[model samples]
Target: MRNNGSDVLLTAIAPIVWGSTYIVTTQFLPDFSPISVAMLRALPAGLLLLLIVRQLPRGIWWLRTFVLGALNISIFLSMLFVAAYRLPGGVAGTVAAVQPLFAVFLARLLLSSPIRPLSIVAALVGIAGVALLVLTPRAALDPIGIAAGLAGAASMAVGNILTRKWQPPVSLLTFTAWQLTAGGVLLVPVVLAFAPHLPAPTAVNLAGLAWLGLIGAALTYVLWFRGIAKLDSSVVSPLLFISPLTAVILGWTFLGQTLSPIQLAGVGFVIGSIWLSQRPAR
Candidate 1:
C-alpha cells in the first residue's frame, strides 16, 4: 500500500467533481431527457476508456462486469434522475445519504470488514448533516421518489461492497472501463424506447457533456474504483459525504442559492464526520 493520505485525497476528488453535476445539468442540459443525458454521460466515456485499454471481459467476468455495471452506473443513475425529477432535491439527497451506512453493513456482510462503533457514528453524523444541508420542512415527498432514492443508495452500497470484494485481475482503468461500458450498453434500450430524440446541442451543451463524460464519468470513476480497491469500504464510503457538501457549496457559490445557518452548521457536521470516519479504530 502507498500513502494512505494520498489515496484518500485522490479518491475524494472524484465525488468533489461530481458535486458539479447538478449545476451543470441545470444550467446547460435542462431541457435534455435525464435518461438520455445519463446514457450520453456514460457511453462516450466508457468507449473512450475502452479505446485506451483495448480489453474486453472473458468467461465469468462478462456477467460480473454487467452486474456491477447495473448496480453501480446504470440503475444508480436512472434512480438518481427519477428521484431528482419527482422529489425535492433535498429529500432526494438526504435519502440517498443512507448509502454510507448501507456500505458499512454491506461490507461487514460481504467483505467481512469490521463493523466498528465509530463507523456507525460517522455514518449517522454524515446522514444527519446531509439532511440538515438539503432537507426543507416544506419539501414534498413522493412515494416513488423516496423509494428510488432508497433503492439507489442500496444499489450503490452493494456495488461498492461488491467492487471491494471482487478484486478483478486487471488494472483499475480496465476495471473501470468494463463497468462503464457495460452500464452504458445496458442503458441503450432504455433510452431508445423511453426518451425522445434530442435536439442538436449548442456549444454550451456540448461543453457540459464533455465535462461530464470526460471528467465526471471516466476520470472520477477511475479514481473512485481505485479508492474502493485500496481503502476499506468503511473508510471510502464516508468520503461520499463530500459530494453533497460540494453540491451545497457549488449551489451557493455559483447558483446564488442562499445557505442558511443550519446548512452551514451541517457543513461542519459533514467535515467532522469525514474526518472521524477516516480515523483508525482503536
Candidate 2:
C-alpha cells in the first residue's frame, strides 16, 4: 500500500497535469471540435492502456465500466468542453469549483458519509480561492455554459463517489483502462454527428493530442483511481484545488502572466482548504 502523503501527492499529479490542458487546447489544438477532441483524447489513450493490460471487461463489469465512463469521462469532458467554449475560462472554472462542495452532499446521500462542518467550510474557502485564482472581474458567463460547468462538476463528483462505492476486483490499471475505453466508445457516435467542422490536424496538433491522450488521460487516471480507492473521497476532492493553482503558476511561468496580490491570497486559501479537508474528522 502507498503511504498517505505520497498517495495524495501522486494523485495530485492527475489534476496538475490537467492544468496544462487549458493551455494545450487553446494554443495547439485550437481548431478541433470539442467533442471530437474529447473523443480522440480519451479513445487513443484508452486503447493503449488496453493493449498494455491485455484484458477486457466481462459480465457486469461491462455495464459498470460504461456507466462509470459516462459519468467520469464522456459526460464530464463533453460538458466541460461546452463550458469552455461558451464561457470565459475564469467563469467556467469558478462555476466548476462547486465540485468538492457538491461531493459532500452527494456522499451523504449515496455513501452515508458524515456531513463534516469543517469540510463544508473548507470547500467554501476552496471555491473562493479558485475564484480569486482564476476568475476575472470581466468574466462573462453564458447560462448554458454555467449549466454545463455544473453538470461537469456534478458528473465528476458522482463518478468519484461511485468509484469509491464500487471497488473493482482488479488492478487500478485495469479499472482505469475499462472506464476510459468505455467512455471513449460512448463518445463515438457523438463525435460523428456533432463534432465541429475543422481542418486536418497538423503535426503540432498531433503532438498536442498525443500529450493529452497519453499523459493527461492514461497516466493521470491511474493515479486518480488509486487515490479514490485509498483516501476519503472528501480528501481527494479538495485536492482539485491544486489544478487551478498549477494553472495559475504555469500561466505566470510560461505565458508571461502576472499574479496579483489577490491571486496570491487565493493560493493560500486553496492550500489551507486542502489541508483542512485532509485533517481527521473532529
TM-scores of the models, in the order given: 0.95, 0.95
Where model 1 places Cα greater than 4 Å from the true spot, the runs are: 1-3, 87-90, 138-140
In model 1, where is the ten-residue run with the lowest total lDDT?
84-93
Clashing pairs in 2: none
Residue range 1-282, candidate 2, lDDT tens digits: 223898888988988887777677777887887788788889989988999999988898889899999999999888877776777555677777899999999999999999999989999999999888877666676899899989999999999999999899899999989898989999999887777465688999999999889998999999999999998888889888787677678778878887889988999999999989888876
| lDDT (Cα) of model 1 | 0.87
Clash pairs for candidate 1: none
Candidate 1 Cα deviation (angstroms), residue 150: 1.8
Per-residue lDDT of 1-282 in model 1, one digit per residue for the tens?
232999999999988987777677777887788788888888899999999999999999999999999999998877876776676555677778899999888888897887899999999999999888988676788999889989988999999899888889999999989999999999999988988688799999999999989999999999999999888888898998888788778878877878889998998899899998998867
The lDDT per prediction is: 0.87, 0.86
Q: After superposition, how far is residue 48 of candidate 2 from its true place, in Å?
A: 0.7
